[model samples]
Target: MFANPMILFIQVMNSLSLAMNLFIIAAGLTLIFGVLRIVNFAHGAFYMVGAYVALSILRVTGDSNLGFLLGVLGAGALMGAMAFVVERGLLSRLYDKEHMLQLLFTFALVLVIKDLVKMIWGSGQYSIGAPPFLRGAVNLGISPYPKYALFLCVMGPIIAVAIWFFMERTRWGRILRAAREDRVMLNALGTDVKLVYSGVFVTGAALAAMGGALAAPRSAVDPGMDSLVIIDAFIIVIIGGLGSLLGSFVGALILGFLTVMGSIYLKEWVIVASYVMMVVILLVRPWGLFGKADEERH
Candidate 1:
């Protein structure tokens, strides 16, 4: 009956690991919405690009721990650079356009990126093994735990704290918040709203890419992987409340636990469970668990 302490410990670790990885992805989605007010459907594409790009780098660098590190950083940087170009060259032009047009633009971007990825990487599944150092298990009191999973658990909290500090304590963070509230006024104040928007988009894309790179050790990198992940990311953001980072963190944890537990119990019905949770949350608190009402946001 899933009662063993060791079993519970393992499940906890699995859940935490999944939650952390998912949080990494969902945080970027939420951040983009927080400032730019754009619901980027292409975030998942950015994530997939990161994994593929990292895979390319690791192939060249011999897949050492250093190579993995380089791949992760490089993926982030490359995606960031690409994002800057897109933001400045294309997306910025649509800033004043209608939301429907924005949606079409991003949706088109998704198709373009997907096709481009297939052209470059072909249609094949590839796996990225964890660094040799992280391939083993570590003793965690009652049961042995995977080093990679443990690393993710620790990393999740560290990233959450770092982002929290950046958003709450830093000067640019304040500008970002102010820009989110009133981009026109911020621009009037000589803050270079376009530059700030570009930075936000770049940071968001880089985060997605880095998240993909970090996750490659555990998942298959393949075409169309972004499709399912976009669903997960959107669910997290919607339930967490769009534009709310704290909400995304908590929501990711919730989805992570539900996903791990449901896979054990419900099997194929696990997806149904996620939908149910989303539905109930929507019914009870449309604003999300940690999200504010739209009126409050205004």
Candidate 2:
């Protein structure tokens, strides 16, 4: 099997796409957790909504490259605004409350979002077709696969770089990073803490939503997706080291490769194998592969 270089390369490409999607969701999650100190369980809901939004837009706009881009951006903006409302209207008040209460509130949000999606889209599985340009495979002299996946693989790192640049080079990113380090001091120094929190939530939610949109063509959108995506996301977040963007990327790649390889080699026990890998990672490096302890230290 190893002799089939094309097979190996395609599998590698598949793993990369999966990793990219995971990174998109986890990047937002890490940022939010890094700054807000709240584990927003509603993130999965945001992702689900994104898939639905993209599906709807694509259905209306027909299959085209422009439609896909519009669908992704539209999903991002819509979810970002929704997160803004949720953060400001509901989660904002719970900031000082206990962790249980905070989790409960987000948990309720998960249910609410689920029902809302069902009501709007109905409880049915749906998928989007790849745009005309992305329909076929880029032949690697072996088995051909979808070109869209390759596009996703490229776009993923471009996005990651953009996010890193924003966080490290821009003033807003600096302010956000500063807020993550010490909200109390930032507030004391006259920075508007509430606004910063809202911005972070919106940014994170937007990325999660876009991830859903990007994954829509490859995966079906349905009711159980919220729970399903969240579980994978949780693993990615934990493995990457909580609140570390770079960690999220690394963690996603590891899980992506493990899942792809396991499915190919251990089809009967793929799920079990994946979790076992996670267990080993956690046992050896509880803080995650590139994650440092005390992430909030300024």
Candidate 3:
């Protein structure tokens, strides 16, 4: 009934947990788009890879917690390496080309990665158990909360904070920001813009992969996951304003809360509600909630 505040609270937490994962994926997409000016449709493929890697390692290692950590780290490293190759080997060649061409190349990558995953793992759903240490539940006033959900809530913010610190406080971060703003100026100043681009792509891929790996225990890894995730993530990136980390966080919260509320009330229209919100936001603010139009031409 309306009197149960606990139910509402539990739902809020659930939405936030989902938003955290979305934020991770959107953050990477925003950064890559902001700097390299490519949408990297394959980002979701990297996310799927994370889940698959986590599932495989967990089964092989037979250690839940270690598997979790290794899954994240291993997926990040492998995806980063893959992205590095794509950026340095392929994208670098298309730097002077039209945006549409670059996007089409990434689009082709999406299909390749999807089939590769299916070929290697088959088109089946897979999952791993939560670590024994986090196998219990904590009762909230509204409903019992899974320990795994609580752990995710905590880790998500920590990651957000860490990324903020790296982007705002480090020298490398400064160089990257400058590259985003003025690639020609950066290159003229003796910076290797190609290296900068590669670095950004790899970092973004790693973040997406880590998010996927972290989520594997909570959800099954399925073949359709890549494209399924890209749609939602793209909405988040667009609503948050391209290239803004803080925007990504806020957009994630908005979409997360909306989905949770809508699912509870209008379960059939949950997906529709997300896109509807995106439409409303775009109609009102084309530049996005936090993103400004880029002045630099590629």
Candidate 4:
């Protein structure tokens, strides 16, 4: 399989594209966990909803390139608004409750959203095509790669840099980092930590939806899609270290290669390989590869 240079190069490109796609989804997850301390099981459901929303928009706009842009933006906006309301009215009430209650709450959200999705879009699967501008292959000297795949490869870093700039360079970013360290102290300093939490939740949820929208062109839009992607998102975050954006990025790359290459080499045994790698990483560093020695949020 590795003998052909052209084939090997294309496979590497595939892995990079996959990694970026996964990173987009997992980034929000790690952010929410890092700040709110909520292991949001409903995140996957949010992603599914985004794809469906995009699908509906595409139906209305009839596949125009402009329509695709609208679909992605609309999906993010709608999901973010819904998340803001949910955060304020529901999730906020349970922030001080037991962790199990929070877990159960998010799990319940998953069930509710899944049912609503089925009711609205039916239980069938739908596929979305890339926009006209992003269709066809681009010549990359050694190999011609799909335009959409290359788009994903570029998007991942652009997003990472944007988020990093927000987190490290902005006042709000410092506030979030402060909240991660000691939210109570930040609150006592008159920071209105509740608003911060709500904002984080909304932004995180929006990112999940946008990731879903961006990903819809490459994958199926189905009711059960969340179940699969969420597992991958968790693995990426866990392997890279929960709540660390850098960790999620690195972790995504690791899993991307493992998944792409492992399928070629290990085939039927590929699924087990992921968990085995996770277990080994845990044994060596429970906090994850980029997780801090003192990663616990106050």
- Pick the lDDT winner: 4
Instruction: Report every candidate's CA lDDT.
Output: 0.92, 0.87, 0.84, 0.93
Error of 1 at 225 (Å): 1.3
lDDT of 3 at 82: 88
All candidates: TM-score: 0.97, 0.94, 0.94, 0.98
How far residue 120's Cα lies from its native spot in candidate 3, in Å, is: 1.4
* Model 4 spans > 4 angstroms off: 295-298
lDDT by residue (88-187, candidate 3, tens digit) is 8888998889989988998998899889999999997887777877888987655889988888778767877887888889988899889888899999
- Residue-wise C-alpha lDDT for candidate 2, range 199-246, written one tens digit per residue: 999999999899999888888888888788888888888888888888
Q: Is candidate 1 or candidate 3 better by TM-score?
A: 1
Model 1, 189-220: lDDT tens per residue? 99988888999999999999999999999889
The residue pairs in collision within model 4 are: none
Q: Is 2 or 3 the stronger prediction by lDDT? A: 2
Give the C-alpha lDDT of model 2: 0.87
lDDT of 4: 0.93
Clashing residue pairs, candidate 1? none
